[model samples]
Target: MENSIILNPEKITADLYPKKFGKAGKIWTVILIAVCAIGLFAYIRQLNKGLVVTNMRDYVSWGIYISNFVFFVAISLVGSLITAIFRLANVEWSTPLTRIAEIIAVSAIVFASIIIIVDMGRPERFMNLFIYGRLQSPIIWDVVVISTYFFISLLLLYLPLMPDLKILNQDPSKNSRFLNHLYRIGGSFWKGTKEQLKINNKAVTTLCIIIIPVAFCIHTVTSWLFATTYRPGWDSTNFGAYFVSGAFLVGAGGVITAMYVFRKAYHLDKYITDLHFEKMGRIVVMLALLYLYFNVNEYLVPAFKMKKPEEEHLKELFTGSFAPMFWFAILVGMIIPIFILIFKRGRRPLPMFIAGVMIMVGAWFKRYLIVTPTLLHPFLPMHDVPESYKHYFPSWEEWAIAAGSLAGALLIMTFFVRIYPIIPIHETINEKNEMAEKK
Candidate 1:
């Protein structure tokens, strides 16, 4: 039965195949473009009026924008984790998921680059980082590493896409004249010759090897931005591990969420089955536990020590202004989902969707904790700034921009699914052939 399912490609593939966006898809695209335009306008306003428009003063300088940047980078790691790791490990079942993971990685990393620039106090001065970039500063490392990560991720996405684009180019019905021409130009050279295939495969493998270190560098540098500081919560000896684990957890949660939505919308249950969700639920649960362990180390030890600098920050999260958010993040993000996923029923699609949503929402707050709380507990007391600067809440403009970036990601994923085979048709067929030969 499994062989039959694999050998005879389901008609579902034809039905679910990447199609040009219909009216619904086009409308969705337009809405995202409009939202993004408004955000660009607001950003221009902020740039003209100075950072004063942001309500972020020196103490709370890193606000929603920076947190949003971290979220994008964290989620981008899904590409390296799921797609490259599984492919190189020769995990056959993962073929259906590689495109999804790769697209998410590419989209998130693209925006990770953008959002960090948005967070810059002097974006125009960004060239200064290049002109006068110092190896000594974590910021320079972040810029260098993130750019490398983005390119490798883009290559990882594009390399696999070559074969698929060749397939897509054959379908005169599914693309526009422009897209048809684009594919012709982009992939006309790819005839899928055995030599070409061998070379392409080797290149992907090499990139898979290289991206691991590049991915680690990007996130570790993000953590260093905090750990290098003298601030209490950010000063933790365990910051790097804590950041990496939580990053993966959130990233997996994102992939799971997107998987469920795309599976249903595209009617891909024949490919992305309950089995994938069940397996993903188990992975997410493990990551959550790992992150929870780090969370204990991150906060519990600090809470236990009650260090003079840590006191105010800990109080703020435990019983002060941030208490409700803190507990909600823990309960909704980690604890409840962990328990739910352990149950057989909970690993099913609907419950897993609920868990995915919880994890993603919690991850946002987790980034907030990583960002805002540290600023609130700056080495010096909050003074000489407007009272508004003392508190951190994303202005409507901020929310609009963040939401637009997310919408942009969805649009990219949506259009990608429309144009390319979301599940690798060629790879799936090859694997099935190999299995049949073995039999």
Candidate 2:
């Protein structure tokens, strides 16, 4: 007779429970808070001085803030990709990564909203959009879809989190009294009965179904914000799919980066094994290739035509002022990552982490290229505008605020990990039990 081994539920709980942050975590948190503080200070200055403090001008109306907003929107797609899409597809290897992706999605979307407000000269007028907005506008579409996506993403995050909350509440000894109290408040009604699990599973499945289109809509509408415009580079039918593919790529890179960080920080080697990174590396390669194809479609076809309106803009990106950053984004974001992740040995944790960072950094520059260069090369051409209007560089204040927004997003994820099990404990136990029985 063969002996079957079963994972100890208590041991699993002990290994997976959220633990107090050590010295390094405390230092990291403090640094993020400090960056957020600096960003807030910069925002206040911008508020007091108005748009004059920044380098945005008539020709280059949109700047790094818009780029950051696009980046946030792009990265937020990961929640839908990892959590909802993976769940619906029944991909078991992704189980440990769902919450990490969810928190990143939630945090990214929250900052996306914030950074857009930071872009507006009159932040107070944001409510007027709701009071006096028109449905025909792509802006209105973006606002509606983003708000809808946020809520659905939140529910997807919370619904799956309840079971873990119940486990945390039941095991008060592992948590601080305050954390235990918060857990009970959140999960007190969750008795883990069959009916409750059934309803929860159903709700999660329903959200998975709903979030897919909503996720596509959110980024698609955002791409429309540019595509609907008559600007040189903005006029393209390909923007929707272009933006969506890039979003998935960046979002996946973000998840890969976080997977490595959390696995190291929390000593989750057993849970977040190299196999997960290997699988994600494959996904990233595919996404990067898809995005690269879109990049070709976006630029190559236009460059081939050299449309008078688009010629200067394309030149600026290809062999002109923006050439360095443009090539950096392409090579680092797509080509190099493709090469690195294409090989099996490169799928290991450290190499994958390096590739993930490359993808993210390159993606940010790619967004910048998408926004700024075209604005500088509008259809009307520069005439009688200030030399300052001919050029655009983010002011110190803009850089500070952008850095702060990124830091703030990181802070949200950091705090979430501190309070909740970054990996779902109850789900892991159930998976282990099933695996044991199968074995």
Candidate 3:
């Protein structure tokens, strides 16, 4: 009842103000920062020594960095799902999750950009993509869409926060000098008048509509990055749906993970309730099945045909050296989680969290499998290259950069939660009020 719109405004405000992190939060922040620093050191070493520090060669031109990039891009789709998709569908239960999803999308996209840059050993040559880039290239399309996606995501996150910002601005006690200053800067023009509210809602609706296709474009074009290639595994028409479906699965899983963490860390159990987890669990299962369908289409058709090129590639994934990781990704990422979450009890917070972690870790390895094995099965054999070129493994520097990018994404999410209310306070209040009225 404290969160109901009928409740005293002051109490609702008290529930939503950003809280100072406790000892555990502080320690977690430190760990993330330290990991980022280590990654930075490794990047500096790479800059000094060149890509020689990594195990990459002609055969395995793409490695974990590309996989990490794919992972980031995949998880970033949550913005479209929870924010745009749910909002447009008028699913009020998702009100509390939009901000968190937007933040995750923004953070993941940020690191997606960074990891791509990291993949380009000579960062200075990045401008070549602009000056010398062809319009037909999927890479260029990716650049255009991802940049658009990031800005749109930022706007989506900011627009909903305007009312809350006005709240924080009015009460000096609610936030410190810097935060209050941010509140003023961001929401000073938002008067919450009838005209302003109408315009804001219209703008949000328009953005939600626009972002959905752009979201699909980013991952679809990303899949084209491989599919357009002549390699064995990459040469599939199903790649677009495969990548997009997997993106939704991982993005949903990431949201579930964030929901659990924020619910516990910020004592948001009142806002992000068990029912929320139940709904998200059902969503995860649906997405997992969708992804599984794509996985079957991606693999089974090729297996049935068994062309010379597809033969070795499918063998590698089915029963060869990559079998363990391949099976692990499929089983943990989709199958096991599906089975667990099929039960009502599995939709609980803890089980959902476990399933989310499994999906995420498995998805990461899935991306790795997507990029690496195909390169290993190129159209031609590696004749003159060293034995190292024949086998691909990420070097310490590569792992450091990849891990650092992941840590940095989480760090961004952590800092955002520290600064802003993870749940949309105004929206939650309105939702509770509506339910109360209905009752």
Comparison by lDDT, 1 against 3, better one: 3
Flag the better candidate by TM-score, 1 or 2.
Answer: 2
For all candidates in order, the CA lDDT equals 0.83, 0.93, 0.91
Q: Write down the TM-score for model 1.
A: 0.95
- Model 1, 162-187: lDDT tens digits are 87677767676667887788788878
The segments of candidate 1 whose C-alpha lies over 4 angstroms from its true place after superposition are: 1-16, 22-24
Estimate the lDDT of model 1. Answer: 0.83
Residue-level lDDT for 351 in candidate 1: 90
lDDT (10s digit) by residue, model 3, range 1-439: 3233254445556776788889999999999999999999999999999998988999998999999999999999999999999999989888888998999999999999999998887999999998998999889999998899999999999988988877767777767889888878988887889998898899999999999999999999999999998889889899988999999999999999999999888877777889899999999999999999999988998899999978998999999999999999999999999998999999999999999999999999999999999999888887888887889989999999998999999999998887887887777667667777797
Model 3 residue 113 CA deviation (Å) reads 0.5
Candidate 1 vs candidate 2, lDDT winner: 2
Least accurate stretch of 10 residues (summed lDDT) in model 1? 1-10
Clashing pairs in model 2, backbone N/Cα/C closer than 3 A: none
Query: lDDT-based ranking, best first?
Result: 2, 3, 1
The TM-scores of all predictions, comma-separated, are: 0.95, 0.98, 0.97
Give the range of the ten consecutive residues with the poorest summed lDDT in model 2: 1-10
Cα misplacement distance, residue 298 of candidate 3 (Å)? 0.9
